[model samples]
Target: MQDLAIWYEGTALAGALRGSGHLYMVVNAAHILGIGLLLGAIIPLDLRLVGIIRSGPIGIVGPFLSRTAGVGLCIALLTGGSLLSVSASEYLRNDAFRWKMALLGLGMLTIAAQHGGGRWRRAVETGVPDPRTRFLAALSLMVWLSVLLSGRWIGFL
Candidate 1:
């Protein structure tokens, strides 16, 4: 792992990012925008799924928000990879970074499980919240919030 990190640090992209202040700033800003998009989309959808906002129909809102959040996740991963390449060695050693990665993996799996479940499909088709769907929603909310927090912790730790 250390050797891999060393190779990453020696890569041209990493060198360029490390050498250029303006480029780094742009990448960082893009990363933040991606995160904002993700959180903005997911939180509202989660709220609806959890029955916090009962006015809007979940069937109508769920697909749209999920798609939007998917796009955000793609953007975040792209930018995050670039950022990580800029300081791979340090980040690989950071406990917060590790936690963030673990949470991200769990979050993705949770999403897959939620979408794969028959109950989720039933809820989507019937415009009703099943217990399983609600449970997944709550789990998603917690996982994503923890991911966000851990990502922030990477900087301080």
Candidate 2:
């Protein structure tokens, strides 16, 4: 991991970012925007799935919100890699960064499990969540919130 970090630090892109504070700031802002988009769409969708915000039909709401959050996830990944490259070695040493990565993997796997489940497909069509769907949704909320908090902890640590 340290070797990988050293290679990342030596990359041309990282060199450019390290040489320019303004560029780093812009990338950081873009990362934040991505986080905002992801959370903004996902939280409401999760709440709806778990029966917290039950006003709208999830059949109508779920797909749109999930796709929007996907876009955000892509953006965040691109910008976050850039941010990490700026100080890869330091980040690798941060326990918070490690936690964020693990939680992120779990969150992604949870999403895959939910989408791959027949219950999820049926719930989307019937506009009602089954037990499995609700459980996955609830788990998604917790995992994503932890990822967000862990990301913040990385900066502090």
Candidate 3:
């Protein structure tokens, strides 16, 4: 796998990005900022969903938080893809990176599942209800935290 990664690193994609030092730095910064924004957006809503902010209307907070998360997701994807393009095959074999990617994927899917339909939106639009909403909140919290941890671990591993 290391040999394959080396080969891949020599390919046109990685080669194109190899000496782009400042660009890599910029991408790294953007990735960090994106992750920060994502967590900021989700954490409050997760708290609300868990019934901490039961008084407010769900429609107000949920959409705002969701949109903020969407923006973060877009930024993360753009910067992350740029970073990955410079070393795709190596990342593919990186266990921690693989887990980060998987968790990121799952977290996005979970968000989609929660807000994809009108009925689902309507149900939670007023703010999440008791039991189910709390469970969903916990899931959201866990997924994003895992993504963050695995992403950080990728650097060390």
Best by TM-score: 2
Task: Look at candidate 1 and tell me the lDDT of residue 148.
Answer: 100
lDDT of 1 at 55: 74
Query: Can you tell me which runs of candidate 2 are displaced by over 4 Å?
Result: none
Q: Which scores greater on TM-score, model 1 or model 3?
A: 1
Clashing pairs in 2: none
Count clashing residue pairs per candidate.
0, 0, 2
Model 3, range 1-157, lDDT digits (tens) per residue? 6676667677765666677787678778998888888999998888777776666577777778878888988898888877786777778878999999899898987787666656447646544455655676778889999999998898787
Compute each candidate's TM-score over C-alphas.
0.94, 0.96, 0.82
Q: Give the top-scoring candidate (lDDT).
A: 2
Q: Which stretches of model 1 miss by more than 4 angstroms? A: none
**Residue range with the least summed lDDT across 10 consecutive positions in model 1:** 117-126
Q: What is residue 133's positional error in candidate 1, in angstroms? A: 1.1
Looking at model 1, residue 15 earns an lDDT score of 86
Writing each residue's lDDT as its tens digit, candidate 1 over 57-93 gives 7778888888888888888989899989988999999
